[model samples]
Target: MNERNRTVVTEFLLLGFGKLHNLRILLFIVFLFIHIMALTGNVLVVVLVVFNQSLHSPMYFFLSQLSLSEILFASNIVPNMLWLILVEGGKVSVDLCIRQFYLLAAATITQCLLLAAMSYDRYVAICRPLHYAIIMTFTRQLQIVIFCWLMGFMLSLIVYIFLDELDFCGPNIINHFYCDIAPVLELSCSDTSSVELATFLESFPVVLIPFMLIIGTYISILRTILKIPSTIGRQKAFSTCSSHLTVVCMYYGTLTSIYIFPPSNNSVDANKGLSLLYTLVTPLVNPLIYSLRNHDIRRTIAKFLGTL
Candidate 1:
């Protein structure tokens, strides 16, 4: 390798949001508001789920986990983004960016597994109502939740460990808001094939498998709902699921576009937009989609707020 390819890079230049820096103050204000809103929305869901006796079910349990993951997910990127936009020459240490990548991946995979768990919970409730309580016991719920977090961390940890093998030379400018795995890989002078392959192997299970499971579960759910004899019963069943489905569609849909789509000659700016969809938009929308459409959550929030 050329000496240039082996020189150690201490820091990376992060071109956040590209030309949007022309309106840096405005963008910072906008993202600050977004960060606050995302935190509030997800935190409220988690708080409601924890404090309210009514939402102490397995579904809400998973929802609370998802909310927490959303908080971490957005936190992994947004604050730094706000900080960078407020400053000139946005940059981060190599160590900091790698850590950020680890946490971001963990948050993302946790949500994916949690969503799958939620889908399974829905399946049990909808298709086998009698066996729901028996199957989704407290031990099982805790096990599933723990598994999601551990699995998420473990997968990202694998990638992080492997990341140490790759070397970044000078000209270490990352053309995106955050240290996204792909763009960061593009900067490495060392062979990233192993890490890329490992990332794909690890990410595939979290992304593809959980998504497949969710789809299968929902298919069964749809069939079960169709078999219901009463229109009101069907409406109630559909209402219970419509929110989750909407969020799932949006979440997985955007992720599929970002991950599964073959990387092209498209500008990094284009890919950043896709990242914004999941990293920013999904977290904010999840609470609105799940809570606003959810009568139980709405009532619980109202009751909790009324006392305060």
Candidate 2:
């Protein structure tokens, strides 16, 4: 890694499913459809939560924030993916790639934090019903949401700052659809051990700690549900959490698979597929999951649709 032999790389060629010669156009169409649907669904949720007084609880507020973060997350990745699809292999400037990486990281980390916060909200509602009102005040919810966003950006900023120290010498090719951290690091000629170590250590608090919080909260919630003498009461309480739990499993399962325990062969294709689940599929389906499972969202959506 001699500086004299190092050549500066100003742009990266994203080899995004370029081998799918027969399916490039088809992939583009499918991804475009997903992008549109996911955007529309998340936007509707945000609008409903903002305008509908009935949907103004801490849970709904967190849902709206999750939707907003998903919107940002998907937007940061999908457009570039679509471009890569059409071009077969798209080139992106280093500066633009760094920006995309930062935004994607921030949005996703924000969503993770929001999900943890949502679980805490549910725990308060189910386990401490009497104190729910006093515990999750409007100001407190706002503060929690703000903290999630701030922590997300600050953590991502630390990683972004590390990228500044690395040098991409040559072979400016990223095997994934977008500029993810691992793929970008692979192309760098610098000693990326520190960067890799930082990311690994960072994932603990960023991913594991929040995930563990959710698990602990849910365990308490489950205990509270079991204490209810009536079967109907238990079912009713479980219903409150089932949707969030479903989303949590789906989001974290794919995320941990790709990042925390990346594939043995370092299969870029496998990572891309998993990435699609959280980025495209989850965002599109999240609204449907919540709207179908929650009576309030369904009723509001039904009434809103009936008028149109």
Candidate 3:
């Protein structure tokens, strides 16, 4: 905390998922497979949405953006993780670590806000069909998407600027696979009370506000679904809402578990695994969930494949 005690760390050693000497090759293969699938699946979705005229709608437009964001998100962490797993000595410089942290934070926050916006779009479609078009116009959708990206960028900038000023002296090992804010903060020699408090304060609103919005939208949607006159109509509406709800639950459940709950002696492993779900598994599942459950997406895929 004092000038005499201050020291700067030039590089960081990542501990990664685990250090099973015998299972390094196996872990590499598993993560490599996931990285490939994440890339291929997300890329296919982006390409399909871009090329297929039939897939161009407010929903798919958002889906395309989500797919692109997921691709960028996974790329920011996974590849470096893979390199660390494979190479004998993979060390990251201080500047590089900060850059990775900035990008990862930016992509993640963007995805969270974008997903929340998409949920609202679905709510308007199912809950207020009459006003759906008026509420979610093309211009308005574009504006929302831009706002999401801008907010994410600004938040990441704030956090990273604070991080840049921190001095990391000795014990340069990061416990997790990627360079996250918390783990990085733990290594700093400087007074991190302000930084830690800022992180917590910023996280509260960013995490909860979008979460509350998504929940409120879905509640309205559920009420509308129940009010449908005929049983068949009710069944159809429920089926439609169920898929989106499932994805939302999986995403928000894991996300909240990681961010909302404080890190405890017993909860670190649980937190890491939950982080994997949102970072690796959720992106892989999003396209499959949408394609399997949504008739329009399935039909569009079929029609697109038929021509190809």
Candidate 4:
């Protein structure tokens, strides 16, 4: 390759959503509403957990972490997306693109592991109630959270570093809203076999392993629920798991659609839409789901509100 050919591209044009000039304002207003809801809801969860002494349990600890992760995850994509749609006219620099991709992937992977950890916490709480305190102590939860963040960043960093080195001398238009790996790869001039392989290998544990563990935990939880003799007992158990299950289904469902199916130009567009469900909608729904269904969170919020 010539030196001129090796020159790095400076910026990238995000072909976000579509160029329906007439629909730009409509899209902007819709996204603004979603973004505001996402931020407010997640932040409320964090504040409630922080201020409520009664909610200082292992489960709520993890729940707060998940909310924080969701906030970070949404911020990585939504603000930039809103900027593109409204201010920058849907354009982003190459460095900014890579940074966005890295943050999005890192936050997403962290949430996956955090959910699994929360499930494990629930498993221990339900299946081994007496030992839950010893097993899921503050130190232990901190360790798990730290490990999740570190592992997620390390894995995503490898992919981002490799992608930075790849030549993107072909089409500069990214067909999706944000700087996702699949869409970015489609624009690369150099071969992406290595990057694809790396993504698959690195993403396996981040996705499948945690997914299996969550399923196993829930199965065990369900078996325990069935063994309960009282109707109220079963209902209580179901309520505890329901919100988490709802969030999990919404998140994993969209993620599976994006990854399990092969990425194409059309798939990229579809993926962006699906990404909104988990990245934006799920966060907005999470606090509401937990607050409405989980008695603990509701009580905490009510009590906190009363003090004001």
Q: Residues 1-308, candidate 4, lDDT per residue (tens digit)?
A: 65664545677888776655677788789988988987887898888888778888888888898889888888888877777676535678777888888998899889999989988988998888899888998999899999999988998899888888887766687766788887788878788998899888977799999999999999999999999999999988788888888878877888887777645655655577777676677778877888888888888778878988
Q: For residues 1-308, could you state the per-residue lDDT of candidate 1 as single tens digits?
A: 65442578878998776677578888788778877998999999998889888999999999999999999999988888877777744879888899999999899899999999999999999999999999999899999999999999998999998886778884798777888787788888889989988987886799889999999999999999999999999999988889888988998888888878824746666787888777877889999988789999988888888999
Task: Give the per-residue Cα lDDT of candidate 1 at 200.
Answer: 76
TM-score of 2: 0.97
Cα deviation of 238 in candidate 1 (Å)?
1.2
Between 1 and 3, whose TM-score is larger? 1
lDDT of 3 at 82: 75
What ranking of all candidate models by lDDT puts the best one first?
Answer: 2, 1, 4, 3
| Candidate 3 lDDT score relative to the true structure | 0.80
TM-score of 1: 0.95
Task: Candidate 4: give its CA RMSD in angstroms.
Answer: 2.0
Deviating ranges (above 4 Å) for candidate 2 = 1-3
- By TM-score, how accurate is candidate 3? 0.92
Model 4 compared with the native: what TM-score?
0.93
Question: What's the distance in Å from true for residue 108, model 2?
Answer: 1.5
Task: Report every candidate's CA lDDT.
Answer: 0.87, 0.90, 0.80, 0.83
Best by lDDT: 2
lDDT, candidate 2, residue 32?
Answer: 97
